[model samples]
Target: MAGVGLMVLLLTGCGTLQRGVDMARGAVFGPKGVRPAPEEVAASPYAQLLIEDDAVSAVMLLGNDDDGRTAWFTDQHVVFLCEGDLVCGTHGLSARLDDMRIVGPNPFVDLRAIGQAPFTVDRRYDWHDGYRYGVQVTGTVRRVGEEEVEILERKRTLVRYEEQLSGGVDGKNIYWIDPATGQLRKSRQLVAPGHYAEIEILKPYRRRVQ
Candidate 1:
């Protein structure tokens, strides 16, 4: 009887030890071997808009609503022009990013230089102290009515962190493109939701400059 009890205890302990070994192996090998497939940028029109330039002049209207207060604005004036006389009220209000072009590399990469590309994919990879991370960002071209513009979205993942906290953000941006000129069109980031923020691109590239 004493011998049987000792054997049972030994088996149980061995099973627990094996489980611990499996978990440790998974933690070391799983994330290091996993890499997300690269996204294809050529399939989208927005990608093409990032590399071109437009030379036109036009009026752009920008509208924003926060906590019930709405504002309409344009690059011409920083102060949001009151749409209605009643302290601030506007119906069917919209704005645009005006007179811009795709020039060189994607503008979102560096603010100083005008860069052009058909489409843009921005990604970030980081690893430190047993932690790994990955982030995917993209921008492309879009057309609204007669306006030619670009749009963008960003996504991120914490693959190696303690808890999986994956999130995404959607944004509205516009790039005014020119047909034949190499000059840069105006660029504007509208409002929308991303990383716990509410934003929208009321209007983008509406006006044409002469």
Candidate 2:
């Protein structure tokens, strides 16, 4: 059964935006809770992705996967793409601001501001069979001292934040962010149930001279 499920996923890729939104609404909202506005649930992050930013383009390494996946970011979300796929079919996974417990800016989170405050995280997973899973977890961030990390072949010192999640799933995710920009430098985040991915920001995408 597990093998069959894996095969289906590889063959069909991820689910559609409508399916994902439907699942999110049903799973995230209770009888008394209000449904999210349509604009708030739109899946297309392309407009934001088009903004020219030096730090928007990145590379993410899947858990123990040798192939590196290309990551694109907007002010509100980050989308990971499958290599060599068609433009419309490149989306492998995505994370949005509405799903994140940000402290400062939309995507840029302030580690110091988070301190020991508890926050809620809602992550939506789009599966191959047109199914989506909304996982809600309560988490807290704490400063874990500083560490020297290499980015784009340059070593830099960064503060480490340990994000501990409970409620839906119990796990400890690590994040290293630039204090100056509050942008994530490296992260080991939970992408799905029982699955985690290691992500490191590579050099930003440079547009070729036309």
Candidate 3:
């Protein structure tokens, strides 16, 4: 929030009619820092659409796997396509990624089933940067152990996992998954070379077991 406030101070001096409203509220803070609650996400009397800083709306979930991958849009129609907690592809980002294919078995989708075991998964995606498009990236996924993380004055023990990605992009992808429900709580993934997306799932959608 301090960063945004400092930016507001600097940008406010510039003078533009629309710039006043362009400053963000719920958009700036880091995961370990101050973040909004679940209810603050949807300000409208209608759907969940309205985060103070940006034109951020509630999660606009798409259909099944083929139709969509749990997507949402923000800041000038920027869409993020997510498979569980991992961000697979993106639109409206500086360097775009498309056609993300997770080759073979993906155990990271459910840690409860896999039990935090070290695993490997390969992925292919189109890179808009110099790497070009449709290149493959190899990864070794493993549990880095558990730690206590505090969010909004609440503390929870979360298992931290790191994925060392090689080939197309060389970087580490980190994820925090809830062991009991086998759901992703938050993650930082590289959508393109040198470009990473820090995602925090304020509220996760889970299917009810009948």
Candidate 4:
């Protein structure tokens, strides 16, 4: 009951908009650093559509033994694709065709994509999923194929309330996004007792009309 009460107080006593702005700027540019205005970052292409939301799909061409494939709907529908029957008409159809379909709405948003800079880091607002609280903008530079790429990270907190209802959770979420395409490359969650989950982007694609 004590812990619950504390959570309620923290939520109700969150800092004002100015504080949020200061935190965002500090995280994005570090101390004594100047960054592009929040509006500019929010308006950048990096803030544009990261992936198809209304419809989604992808194929994972794993090695011979594990040739993989997938597809799903963005709205409220979910369907898993089978690898068989995918090559039915080709000469190697029998070898590559695996037809299967399981239903479930697509999972949560692409974490990496959600961490785009300016939108998450430099922006002057919070990104919530109606359940979790997300903040902190992280960017990393890495080598990709012969070129250096910059990636953004989004940190979120997941919540689960008891009978008190307004209590928040204590956890951390990290999202890795590719700035070049604004696609989510990976996502991670860390909770006390050291429980964590990671989702990696192996393949991605836009919806294709049949």
Winner by TM-score: 3
Task: Give per-residue CA lDDT, model 2, range 98-167, as digits (tens).
Answer: 1222222321235556655544433333433224434456556577878999754468898887767776
lDDT of candidate 3? 0.55
lDDT of 1 by residue, 141-197 (tens): 323323433333433111110111122224544433333432223333321122111
After superposition, the stretches of candidate 2 with alpha carbons farther than 4 Å from their true spots are: 1-108, 116-132, 204-210
After superposing candidate 4 on the true structure, give the runs of residues whose Cα lies further than 4 Å from its correct spot.
1-167, 190-194
Q: Which ten residues in a row have the lowest lDDT in candidate 3?
A: 46-55
Per-residue C-alpha lDDT of model 3 across residues 67-169, encoded as one tens digit per residue: 3254433223333344555566555445567657787887766865655577888888876566576677898888888877664346778888888999877
- Comparing 2 and 4 on TM-score, the stronger one: 2
Model 2 C-alpha RMSD vs. true structure (Å) is 16.5
Clashing residue pairs, candidate 3? Answer: 24-53, 25-53, 126-134
Q: Against the unseen true structure, what C-alpha lDDT does each candidate score? A: 0.25, 0.41, 0.55, 0.25
Error of 4 at 179 (Å): 0.4
Cand. 4 Cα-lDDT: 0.25
- Candidate 4 residue lDDT tens string, 1-210: 343343233323322112222221222211221223435444432211112111222111211111233322112211222231111111111111112121232112232232223222111112222322333222221212222222223332222111100112333444444545444444443221123333333333332335
Of the candidates shown, which would achieve the greatest lDDT relative to the real structure?
3
Clashes in candidate 1: how many?
Answer: 48
**Model 1 stretches with alpha carbons more than 4 Å out:** 1-120, 123-135, 143-167, 190-210
Please say which candidate is ahead in lDDT: 2 or 3: 3
